[model samples]
Target: MSELHDEVLRLSGVGKTYNPGTPLAQNVLQDIDLRLARGELCALIGPSGSGKSTLLNLIGLLDSPSAGELYLQGRPTRALDDAARTRLRNRAIGFVFQFHHLIPAFSVLDNVLMPLMIRHGKPDAEDRARALELLAAVGLADFAAKKANQISGGQQQRVAIARALVTRPALLLADEPTGNLDTRTAESVFALFRRFNREFGCAVLVVTHDPRLAAQCARTVELVDGRIVRDAANTAAK
Candidate 1:
């Protein structure tokens, strides 16, 4: 297949400035040109003040860029209306945050089904089955009936991963998904990302501060002072 056919995301001259016309204006990201192909797993690394999260937000369509355009699955995003953006985001993108953000009131199974529920009112039998299967994949099959608040922090994060994957999005954007866990737990959580990236063929862009974790990805993109300074394939990736 051609590059266009395999392209899941592209950003062309993209920039984000918080308050463009005032003294308080701050440029969070600049000239971010990037492309993620189908099933590719890449890591975004940067210092504390860098624009890593800002870039992820733009790619995830949670925020609009201040300049240039973004394309998701070859469709331009700058011209999309609010409803259209929501529809496209739901259909093509999945997000996993450091906080997991599971609903404490819902059961684990219901939590995984939230994305499907939000997209189409109530979920059907197939949706429920898919959620269960994902839970099983994450080793949470036995905890499906438990409330979200009842699970350990690591388990809650697993639920978040399953929830993100329930919609089978073409691209998965993770913003510091392992930032809160212990070393062992973090590796386990990240392993799930790799596993799903391989099995489901979803393009993954994960923001991480850990060099060890970044080294595990096939490609690494480094950011500094709101600009990408390095984007190269890892020769020793495992």
Candidate 2:
């Protein structure tokens, strides 16, 4: 609760179950309560089947919870309609996945502008400037004109980070964003998340398996069998 004054995302008793009937039902998450405040950088860590991604999806508003409620910026989101949810999601949440899903045909700058274009009809000068600025912030200013496929894997991931932050979202959710990168590159990528969280005051909840990576975060939340087993401050490993 470093920035307790303003909570960006809150989950209360949230749970999710897939195919709730016909003998194929499975509870992926259980009663869970978590909160992310502005400017907080938290790591979510657990084993492979611990439901970390499912929890992230619930917080991102990409998937609905089967029980409890999620509040985004203090507004109840569980009851919001599809249109309302989409609007809120676009305005409030940014997502980064393990794979940098940049379009091979689009330039780095254009790919960053894609989010804005989706929300509006076309990109104007201001939007383009913002996208470029984000690229620069991610240390990719010179690569703005390069096609995504032409960049290195680490550079491509940086471009992905820039794309996620182009909209200046209040909450950023990354699911194993560094899982596919080398150890050194993964550390650097994780540092970028820290920089954004501190510089932009955007709350970041990143799912990672590396203990070294998790140790860099201010806070860590561990999930086990869809339940939050530990949520606490990160201290030097003994």
Largest lDDT belongs to which candidate? 1
TM-score for every candidate vs. truth? Answer: 0.98, 0.96
lDDT of 2 by residue, 1-238 (tens): 6454599988999999999975999999999999989988889999999998888888988889999999999999998999999999988988888999999999989999988988886999999999989888888999999999999999989988988898899999998899999999998888899889889999999899888888988889999999999999877621
Residue 212 displacement (Å), model 1: 0.7
Candidate 2: global Cα-lDDT? 0.90
Model 1, residue 39: distance off in Å is 0.7
TM-score of 1: 0.98
Model 1 segments beyond 4 Å from truth? none
Whole-model Cα lDDT of every candidate shown, in order: 0.94, 0.90
